[model samples]
Target: MTAVEEKLQLPRIYKQTVKMALYDLCIVGAGMMGSAAARHASEKSGVKVCLIGPQEPKIREIVSGNEVFGTHYDEGRIMRATATSPLWADLAKRSEERYRELENLSGVQFYHEIGALTVGTRYGQFIGRTKSSLKGGPKGYDNVEILAAKELNDKFPYLTFADNDEGIMEKSRAGYINPRKMVMAQIVVAVNQGCDVIRDIVLNIEKLQGVYKLTTERGKIIWTKKVLLATNAFTGMHQLLKNPVSYKAMPQTVTLAAVSENTAKRLSQMPVVLYEGKGGESWSKTYPRDSSDNIQFYLLPPIKYPDGKYYIKIGHSDDILKGSLELTDIRKWYSGKGDEELEEELFKLLDTIFHGVRFENHHGDACATMVTPGKQPYIDLLSPTLAVALGGNGYAAKSSDEIGRIAADLILTSKWTYDIPKENFKVKFHVPSKL
Candidate 1:
């Protein structure tokens, strides 16, 4: 039989496994990271890999039994190489380099290289760390332009900024990515590389003698030698991790402003903006309400959503609702509109930034971001056979490809192969306090 035919027949064999199909590596959670790791791991010769996760739900109101959700269901996510942390900068730069190659190979288009404008106070901590991260960054990353307040207004008249706010413009390899399409592209490449795609949520995982037996919500049994848990915010919901990873699943809300096609066309040249600090005297009063509520937010240019309409999406850099939500409350949280007060504030902020812009209507939605204590993803092994790649902290969507590659390398070789320190990605467990 031809190699193509052989590859096509493998899934049939896997599905017929009343004996429990065995795979070399099984990755749970087929979101951005999981899909990317599946593609990378499947590239290894003679290795059998499978990616297991549920497809996006059709209804947002109800999440059935064991049905999980992902944060990448949106149309646009910001992509920028200039970050406050050097580690995220490296990961984003590396992933940005592969955007075109992945696009060409998978025949999928997900990246839009319009540019990115980051605004902050003249000597703000965020802007300072962003500048320091560029000290020895990759080539072409140093081609950023510093713009004064007047210059910022002149360049992007559609945006409004405080007089004290300075701007850093990354003209190359920066913009927004359609995360849903990116995940689709990654899974396409993975399947083409001989990986089986299982559309089911992993209900439970029990370690067998030398392998792990994964039980799916649909009752399919999968046995794999090594498992990678890329479960992100839903990590606490799964029984896969023996010692729970130390992470907070905080609630996030985003407001989408729908605009006419003409408005979208007029603002087509608008770059993604990350604004730090107050908007103005009136705007400042409504924002930065407490220590947890920083006056920092980001917005994407008009992007077409699945509904054949265009919207300008905006959200705060951190959680709008405070505190880590209980894992049990996740499904209900997804069903309802996130914090009504924050949604109102977001619309007010949107109107303030875009002063005279016309909008048809606006609405809010809810999602969660997995935050680690150190503000970095935990990409370490839990045991000799089980590994993890959780904790996006609101920055994983853009750098997911490289993060997935690192996760694949760790599992395939059983060692840290990346240049960055493994200690930086060390996994921490949560120990509940006894009353």
Candidate 2:
């Protein structure tokens, strides 16, 4: 054959076989933690990183009917330094410290530093733990103050609390973050640092000759030296590790009450509030009638949604939505019509809190978080070449920057350099079926 004809044949030969792309590290589930890990690993370790995950479903005026849902697929998430545990408190502080830096680097506005309040009876277990956390957890918590009921009322006039209830205010470096924007910011940084982000779902992961091969839903193969699974609730649905990690995929429901623009403007200065019943009771009970029980509910300040209306978001604690969910269950819950009972309850609660304001609209959505038995995240070496970072225990979004750093640290050096106690986040495969 002629030389030109032979070259044409060579091109055809190369096209006959597919080449699998190799990466230094492959991260599955590019949610909050995975996205941050991709940014940190690529920038710090200077290795080729590939982040694989499905894009967040678009936010619609109606919460239901979404194709996919994630905990971080919302407009705002509370970012507070106060926590029931010192470990989480420190992690929140660490994550907050990097927020401004991330925003500047990515040119995305993600954090709102208004403030945060934890309200409950002074003797409540959560309040006591939060007080202790402020006392000993992090240095930036010096501005935290315990406010009496009267003081709370005087300061936050729009909020109504029980006569004996008090509030712990993280006066500075506490607020809400645009979670969707934050993930985009992290991905932007990662991409700028030469990390490749693949918009594909990971079907399975297999180990061959000390290297991990990830099989995607699109039938593509990826070979990597290490793999990090930050799949959160979806972790239970996938067998990514040689030894499976035990976790409960607890689904959480959050409701948002859209108020008039004037109302939102009036409540603009309000801080994120963790509103509890008199003695830390669930807010599910009719308020004012049964005010002497335990309740747990968190409130975010008015933030504009895509529907051109400002909404005040409130989410119930996982204790209320208690159950492990399968992948199909989560997808169905996300895409199905929202719960009318929950929406009504949210309206009643909002009416009780914001008395005179009229709610222009009301909506609700479902998201799931993986909770380990210890109520902390599991970041450990699953196998020789695979490390898993899952189970945010519902607090992963606010502390994700630090968790990501820890995950990347574990994968790169087999150890973490953070001051967080190893026992707090170390992997413990022995988990009970009931959380």
Best by lDDT: 1
Q: Candidate 1: how large is its RMSD?
A: 4.4
C-alpha-based local distance difference test score of model 2: 0.76
Candidate-wise lDDT, in order: 0.83, 0.76
Location of the lowest summed lDDT over 10 successive residues in candidate 1:
8-17
Cα RMSD for candidates in order: 4.4, 8.2
- Could you tell me how far off, in angstroms, the CA of residue 93 lies in candidate 1 after the best superposition? 0.5
C-alpha lDDT (0 to 100) for residue 343 of candidate 1: 82
Residue by residue across 236-283, what tens digits does model 2's lDDT show?
565555445777777677788888899999988999998655532223
TM-scores for all candidates? 0.92, 0.88
TM-score of 1: 0.92
Model 1 Cα shift for residue 7 (angstroms): 17
Q: Which stretches of candidate 2 lie over 4 Å from their true place?
A: 1-20, 59-68, 136-141, 279-292, 430-435
Alpha-carbon runs more than 4 Å astray in model 1: 1-20, 63-66, 136-142, 281-284, 290-294, 431-435
